[model samples]
Target: MRSSPELATSASLRYVDVWKYYSGKPVLKGVSTEFSPGRVAVLLGPNGSGKSTLMKMSIALVRPDRGYVSIGDRRVDEDPIWARKVVGYVPEDPVLYESLEIVEYLSFVSSIYGIDVPQSRVDAVIRALRLEEHLGKFIGELSHGTKKKVAIASVMLRDPPVLVLDEVFSGLDVESARVVKLWIREKASRGGVVVVSTHILPLAEAVADRVVIIHEGSIKADAPPTKLRELGEELEEVYLKLTGYSAEIEELVRALRG
Candidate 1:
């Protein structure tokens, strides 16, 4: 067993033999994986393939029916509050207090998380996401993309060791997406474990050090982008092939052209 200091700074997230079910339907089945420090892992899966559920498990917003998630020696399911202190999570649909201004909302997060250098960190992220202009506006009044920026800011400001971001780039514009990608790389370079899920294969290809593909409640593939794209295939092509979509797409093409 490690000391408290060591456990608090644990640099990796692990899931072992994890299983989850929704209304008697299995969403994840016997899944086991580990995310290492200094790397960015991209989770790729089609709709209803369980990517979101698996990501949610890392933060303990949802727990597995079996198995467990952990950071170093501490089990996330067993010590979720401790886990939250070390992991910064951005969900698929971020929930923020509608009536609060951007700065007030972030102040609330800062207080809740006990951030060490709250104002400086918040200022840095605000500038990075170009939110300085909207800091006084109520969170409810911002556009979806701007609101998403605030959500990203809330997590990134913490600079936590483990980050579980679900569809982070969905509403972001091109430049904001590019900036966030750079931030992701910077975070990983500093030895933070970053796991992001996205449907944009090109974006995933650009950001991922390794890719894990889930399909129908099982891990269909896991490999570095280069290996997954063997023989000069694109990441999208590889994903389609691995997830059994290539054949269906071919059938669609034939029918449409006929």
Candidate 2:
């Protein structure tokens, strides 16, 4: 079992009976969760499970319809700018400035954060993310993995107290992914809150101080991984069971493998 380099203090990000909708269709139905600073928290779910929506609410990108989402003591909706400043968000599919070169793109983001020392900071992030080879390239010309690296590097450069990552490692190559994982650990260790959503159970199992299983826009399980899985259970099995797809999917998977 891997351990978080820093233990989170209890007062981090918390959601209370949060509800949201799209086109009059319910997305998150009374979902509530808490995340702590100085630790890594992960949300796990299948497609359309509202994991991304939850991250959006935390960063004040989208407003909740019924409940409240808070970062530390302040409510997101009530203080959007402050909330955004304190949090760093990376979406699953990132959009970059096509007209700008990679280094220039990063410089622009730093400017939004009111970050001076732009050159040194950009250089440090580029080196850390191994983006030196692609720095000269225009944003549109970069590969998907390289683009993902740039987006992630931009968020990390902000060095906010809260980090919200939606499927952050999906497009990263193995080496880059390792570097990101290490960076996440270091950031959380130094008193930042990192909330990551991924389909990769191993990644979550490896780094998360706590795991949250969201299904049908509600939490089905929330606990430490070891505590979540009893001696005879795996995390996937528990997830399958909670979602009522365990037996059916298992049979199909076995048939395919066999």
Candidate 3:
């Protein structure tokens, strides 16, 4: 039985024996993991470790070819729409209407999410993202970093129980990235579950409560960054060692020297 949404806040996001394939090629295979509220989870992997695929499964954007994904006691596939109602996703590069003003775009997104909050909610997000100056401008006129901020604000406006961000800090300048970090931290403090996937090890180390590394469709390591510090000189060093990227780093240096 599910605890009431107010009481539970988190529903224990879990994936069990999950598998996914693309064009006859397998991506995720027998993957199992769990995520809960009030914590930030970071997913790390090389270019093809199915990190994106796993997020897709959690958000009900893609179905697993085998196995299951569940929130607490409810199966995701059984009611994808309902499942999505509790999840908010911000993709690596969010596409917005170039013709619409930022405010208009936000209004449209909030309507789609069925958020009936007061305009103050939207105003808060705009201020938090530092989007006030650009809200009146057409999205086409905004810079890439500002566009990313707008996308993040759109996701926050819903105040969903779960947030999945894919490289969300990639294009932002240092200050904007810091703002995002604080915003996400506040959400986690409020008992929201946040999962972010990124290749930037330092940023993930800074903000994530737990780090999960995937290699070749399998979890290579999963632990708190502090816990990882005991096993390695630093989290990044252990990540590279575990993911077999240390060899690649040496080869790249050699090639560069050549």
Candidate 4:
């Protein structure tokens, strides 16, 4: 990821009437939304609902076929490397160099981020994620949960203004998951923009300042937790009703809200 002076002050992530297709089928159709600073937004959707695709656009991992994604003033496609510096993205499947020790890999990532994050920040991230002990271990030897923690640590180490995390709680322990929840809320409290995609409804409700339900490449509902609860008690129930699902979101909703 690279930085630019021109984009230094802008971090709001926006997708304006975006569209995407795969094999002639639409994945994200006319998706438009803006993620503002100092807020935690949770995206809830079933598999293949285009949630990941939408999150990837903010960092330029996936470009929209129509419309455009932007971070502040610069269009993501026009300057993806800079967009990356502004957004810290953690994908569902983290890409780790298995051959390297955890410490070695973090040091390499730290170098890539340059002076954007201080060594103290990096150290804090490692400590927060409880990765101190695993630093000497080969990444390949770590458990799935540990690997996930490392990936999260890598991105958080950068201390970017905008964060896009997909299935962030997958493979995490109860304590680690709690820590992540705090991370989300803390970022928003500090005036950073955060987007998190998760299948866990209760956790989602707990961390989000706003909840967005996406289905079949379109938004079914976009509102705060209060507004969502007004639709129903359980978030899954509200999601089911909004997305036209039936019976606990299984019969009417598409798939597991993963």
Give the top-scoring candidate (TM-score). Answer: 1
- Residue-level lDDT for 20 in candidate 1: 94
lDDT of 3 by residue, 173-202 (tens): 787788888877887898888899988888
The TM-score values for the models, in the order shown, are 0.93, 0.90, 0.91, 0.90
Model 4: per-residue lDDT, tens digit, 63-94? Answer: 99999998888899999888887788899988
**Model 3: how far is 248 from its true place, Å?**
2.4
> Which window of 10 residues has the lowest lDDT sum in candidate 1?
1-10
> For candidate 2, lDDT tens digit of each residue in 1-258?
111122225658889999998899888999877888778998999899899999989778888999999876788899988787777888888888888898788878777767664467668878878888876789999888788888898877777778898999898888888888998898889888889998888888888888898888889888888888882368877777876788899799999999
Ranking by TM-score: 1, 3, 2, 4
Winner by TM-score between candidate 3 and candidate 2: 3
Off by over 4 Å in 4: 1-11, 116-120, 247-258
Model 1, position 31: C-alpha lDDT score: 95
lDDT of 2: 0.83
Q: By TM-score, is 1 or 2 better?
A: 1
In model 2, the Cα lDDT at residue 39 comes to 80
Residue-wise lDDT of candidate 1 within 38-84, one digit each (tens)?
Answer: 89999999999999999888879899999999888889888888888
Q: How high is the CA lDDT of each candidate model?
A: 0.85, 0.83, 0.84, 0.85
Q: Rank the candidates by lDDT, best first.
A: 1, 4, 3, 2
